[model samples]
Target: MESLVVPVLILLAVVAGVTVAYRAARKRKTGRPASQAEPAKAPQELARAAADRLSEDEHRRVYALIAQGQAMAAIKLYYEITGEGLRASRDAVGALAAHPQPFRRQEPAQAVEEDDDEPQRFPYRYRAIASKGDVTREVSSNMLNDEIYGRIRTLARSGDTEAAANALTRHSDISLTQAREFIALLDD
Candidate 1:
């Protein structure tokens, strides 16, 4: 009985040590230092430069697709026209949707023209991902953007989880149940 007690105590200690190590590993993997954090708002300069690469026709076509809520098609068109990689095309389209630009004709002799500011629609879906520890969540919807997602994150971090979940469900196609589940996984 004495020998068994020592072995059981050693086994319990090992198990506790392993559990602590696993939790620490998860925390390290999920936590980001201040310097490594991504900017909430994407840089607009990249979008402006990418807008110059599209011709008048392509520009109109991409915007029309965006207006029609065809994000994947718009991304495919941008990739085909620019010969850029898939990720670059996706980023450029996201930027363009966020900040609309007028079509620019490639003719050197012709001057650029500005379109009316009639609130162009970019009704394309965006995917926002949140992860902490071993849990990961993704929200896909047309109503989400950097600003709205940032607000949601702020709400989640501030412990207003119900408000965040409600706002998420209101803005996204997700159900209230799903929104709550997603919100619960956010880093508090």
Candidate 2:
């Protein structure tokens, strides 16, 4: 009888511990303090707005981690670079991978600060390619640099295919139909 009583007490203790743990988890998920919860981020139209957010070296390192399938490391790098909440960092890294943005060398502060409506000419022509299986399409233009191309890709990824196609047409001499086709490939 003594042995049975000891076993019963142990079982009760285990049950109590499980109950406490379950309640704690529930509280964290449903009733967490406002300070402990991450604030929701605004949905930006263009993910390219983050191009200048991370330096070239960090961008390259994160891309390398992504290529090697170390997603968690890439997310950690993004979190460190942007100082964003963990969930936001995860989403940013995922968007980067899905959209495949290129690292742009940082421009001079003066050049960036001068926000004129005129398009700045790049020293070298830029080339962007999208392929699905045997169908490959390439867009080469002096005006279509990494930032613009990244914005175009972001538009395509966000389901604004027509806007992306229009942006491509405006940037390049390609016809609307051709731009649509290229945008379609990017969406794929």
Candidate 3:
């Protein structure tokens, strides 16, 4: 019992000493001298450049997408193509689709001219809600662009003319007349 008591006390003393030393070392490493501290920049000044580069609407959109936890790769690709970052673009898209009152509404459609002179076309938002039997599918503009073109060509080659025409009309931003003309050309 005496031998065990001494060994236990010695072990406790050693542990306490090591703990004190470790804590003291950590404090010494972390505690910077007053002269060594770096000066802080103003938050407004720090954010100014990023703010200037992106509009308020863009910022809101990006932050909202980020909040929604979108994949970084998809966001990066979107940002690369569009000037807006992934988060912002996602937020903007969501706002456009879901919000009752949008912060920025798209401009009115311009008159189509016969001549070569054409105004910039604003990105269109398309949502197709289709129900077949019990299954309902909601297709968005982005999904249509990504998958419809190839599907349309395949369907057309397979002699599924109706399906191809429907797919082309659903995918394209052009009028039904224009889509029909294009699909007719596919036959030729």
Candidate 4:
């Protein structure tokens, strides 16, 4: 037993060293100790508002991780990016992946500080899908619903595609080009 003491002591010391290094690295990366708890975040449920919160690059990154089937990693990334609660991050990632959102440039009137010009914010998000051959696109937004989408579709079928595309862009986060592409699929 006396002869075995040195090797066991060395092994314990190595393990303790590794543990300390790992924790220090984690603290440096996250700006908090590994054992520290995260504070509560705003918005319990992720609506279209989640898409509104993430920047274009961050939105793409989260979706890419989800597409690669790394849900846990995506959740962790979204949690870090948005500083949202773990549960909210998970839900946001799931929602964002299921219905991909294109980045919409924020209009001056849409700022949160203004009360009067703020467009209506919805609790639920709506999805409208259009496909031509193997190419498919989806527009998901809180500003759209079944009745509104039907009207847009009617505008497309009536040979008023430009108007329809404009309406789609108004309702969703997609750009004019993307809205036109989506409208092309609906033109039939």
Candidate 5:
């Protein structure tokens, strides 16, 4: 009886030691804080968070595309990659067509200045995927508006010029005069 009791005690001690060692090994393998052990964010949620950082114009363009009834799948893919929605992307197009304000030439004497130097400003350009691949090209406000004008001209230059012109007049916000001007420019 004495020998059996002694062996039983030894076995219990070994089991406890083994359990402790196993737990330590697991902790080392994970190497994370206890609070961080909860489930991680999904890829889609992370993508949306990243997309939220896009510029206002970019956001407007994305929203505009959404308004235009583009596929959600395509919009989602674009948002994930470029951090822009359809509406924001389209608004960016309108902004590109507007004149830009000049950079401030001088600092105000009365204003308190900080230690940090002002960062250099550059011209804003639209980046679009063209046939030549991804191109970052500068465009004037006139050029930007010209894109809309050119589209109208292409439609009018085809088989039913009058019908195309009428369609442009009806569907577009631009006046009929503007459409005619664009068509004439295309002819030239």
Candidate 6:
């Protein structure tokens, strides 16, 4: 038994080394990652966006499917209604399940305009929030990207609150008074 100890120790060390090398090589051969990635939208914001893509009846059915623990059915329903790819529909369903968002009427124009350059559809959504004291306001829309939001912020910071409010209302579904209230917090 004593004579076999050294050989057994060497065998174990060799096996460990081979296993480590195999894992390292496997990690290097993974599928290629996305070439470009947009900043992630908030999960609740995404849930709201997903819900907004559905019409009233579709929304009810999708939520019902989700409540019944039928994830695939919910995803399928969302995909059929929104015409999104399988992966996006799955992700949207997951987000919706994790965070329940209120149903706001989605404009038809806002739903299909994500692709501007080559007419590809994108599921990205944006949400802007402002709060002062006990008052808070939120704006969610597909039309409000980071650049547009930055411009609105710049306009507000430059003392052009009215123009900022106008721009906010143009990109979001909020009313002018609500936009003004939202803009006021950003000026600080």
For model 1, how does the per-residue alpha-carbon lDDT over 1-188 read when each residue is reduced to its tens digit? 89899999999999999988887776677695434655644548767867899988889999999899999999999999999999889999989998998876666866535222221224787898877788888998877777778888899999999999988887787899999989988875
User: Residues 87-182, candidate 5, lDDT per residue (tens digit)?
Assistant: 653333333223222222333378644211231222543222112233222222212233443554566566455654454445344566654543
| Model 6 Cα lDDT, one tens digit per residue, 1-188 | 99999999999999999988877666666533233335678888889889888878888899999999999999998999999999889999999999987778855574544432232222777888888888888888877888778988999999999998888877777899988889999856
Q: What is each predicted model's overall lDDT from 0 to 1?
A: 0.82, 0.80, 0.53, 0.82, 0.46, 0.83
Top candidate on lDDT is 6
What are the per-residue Cα lDDT tens digits for candidate 2 across 1-188? 88799899999999999988987887788688435675654334224555558888887898899899999999998888899899878888777777777777776766455222355667778888999888999888776787899888999999999999988887776899999999999965
Candidate scoring better on TM-score of 2 and 6: 6
- TM-score, each model? 0.36, 0.38, 0.28, 0.37, 0.26, 0.39
Which pairs clash inside model 1? Answer: none
Model 6: CA > 4 A from native: 1-36, 107-188
Best of the two (4, 6) by lDDT: 6
Which residue ranges in model 5 land beyond 4 Å of their true spot?
13-151, 170-172
Give me the candidate number with maximum TM-score.
6
Better model by lDDT, 3 or 4? 4
Off by over 4 Å in 3: 1-19, 26-146
Give model 2's clash tally: 0
User: Could you give me the TM-score of model 5 versus the true structure?
Assistant: 0.26
How many steric clashes does model 5 contain? 20
